[model samples]
Target: MSRYESPRVNAGAAKVVLIVLIVLVVAGLVAASSVKIVDAGTRGVLLHWSAVDLTQPPLEEGLHFVTPFADDVINIEVRTLKYERSTTSASRDLQTVRTTVTVNYHPEKEMIHYLYKNLGLDYENRVIQPAIEETVKQVTANYNAEELITKRPLVKADIQDEITDRLNEFNLATEVISITDFEFSLLFSQAIESKVEAEQKAFKAENDLLRIQVEAQQQEAQAFGIANANIAEAEGEAKAIRIINQALAENPNYLEWFKTRAWDGKLPLVVGEGGTPFIQIPISP
Candidate 1:
């Protein structure tokens, strides 16, 4: 026999090589299944044997190692996320209203696993959004559409507060909320506009009435003043005429002096009855 066995040993060596290749492939597969990477702004929930591992904390962002083909990772976003929805409801006055809202929120880091277990990825849609709609309706029912427009800030605050309280059960915290849009029915809008216009017209009419009253009072005061002035002037003239008559009775020549002083440069067109004609006789002065 030769020192090396024929084909049997060679076959045995081939079997060993095949066994090593299979082991390496299995190891590669295990490693491939074990390693996982969680990107930024996300946390990974761990599931061991298809059941969640409650004791284990959520895997932070980056590479993680879990049991190959046994443990699974469910990525839960911990970053702030915006959820927008529209709601149509009736106001307190039964006016139809359409409202749009944007809610900014994030998972409670400590309760994320609990959130996932309870609500899952549809958390916002199932819980948060529904809660928002309900809250908006509850608050909106208390105010008319007109009050809603005037009290928008108050309404927004009420809705945000109520929704936050409701979503607390889902382990979600609301960061910010905005009521982006509000609309009333066409009839309501037109009625509001007409009401405003009527109020403006009524106000203008009131102002016009006040202005007229003030002007009438001022004109009355002015007329009274003019009448008093005329009365005083006539009384002064009568007093002067009485004084002149008394002086003439005391001294008859005073009338001639008065006539001489009262003469103007122009002659009368026609002398009055029994009055002196234009006879400028030269006086021996």
Candidate 2:
């Protein structure tokens, strides 16, 4: 009897199915909106109907639940980020200086909502960049071009401190700042190079002069030693001659004895015309 349903009943059934489908779809959307996932290294800033909620702390990493369809979560990365900028400024000496700097920073997690409210996500361009540029320019202007190159560590510290203090006012934490590169006008660079080259040459010249002086001193010492040795030998020879003379003057017989000791057994090859031997004996008086 009811093999086929009436068109009215079929129409009513179709309406119910469509209504259920619509409800399920709405429920799915609501559920999706209710859940929020704050990824790792990021914090969620909750907003109520487009208004930032300042009363609550930022939602930490992981799943969170919020009012469906009425609340929104804005993710702000709390992890370290790098920002690099190239800036041109003037040194105290009125020299044009170009500098490239890098800054590692992150927003304070507790104050992320405020950061989002005030500077939004593009804070790097709005705040940090300008702060870096201004701080570099200001700090650079305090040092001469040569001082900027020579006192690089001090310059870096000054710039970093300035940037840190400036960013702290906006709840952005600066981890570290690096002065990656420095450049000057070609003429200035060449002048610096020439100055350095001159300094190096001067140092070498000083060292060479010292070495030469040392060598001269060594030569003088050697000559003095040799002269003393020659004088000593001459004095010894004269002393020997004086001792021999004294021996001979004290006793003329010593001469005969010395001659006899020095003579060989062989006789003289030549004889006097009178056929007498040329050797004569000294008589002691």
Candidate of highest TM-score? 2
Clashing pairs in model 1, backbone N/Cα/C closer than 3 A: none
Pairs that clash in candidate 2: none
- How do the residues 204-233 of candidate 2 rate in per-residue lDDT, one tens digit apiece? 999999999999999999999999999999
Model 1 stretches with alpha carbons more than 4 Å out: 1-6, 206-285
TM-score of each: 0.72, 0.86
Model 1 scores what on Cα lDDT? Answer: 0.89
Q: Give the TM-score of candidate 1.
A: 0.72
State the lDDT of candidate 1 residue by residue for 173-277, as single tens digits: 999989999999999999999999999999999999999999999999999999999999999999999999899999987876776677785777777668856
Each model's C-alpha lDDT? 0.89, 0.93
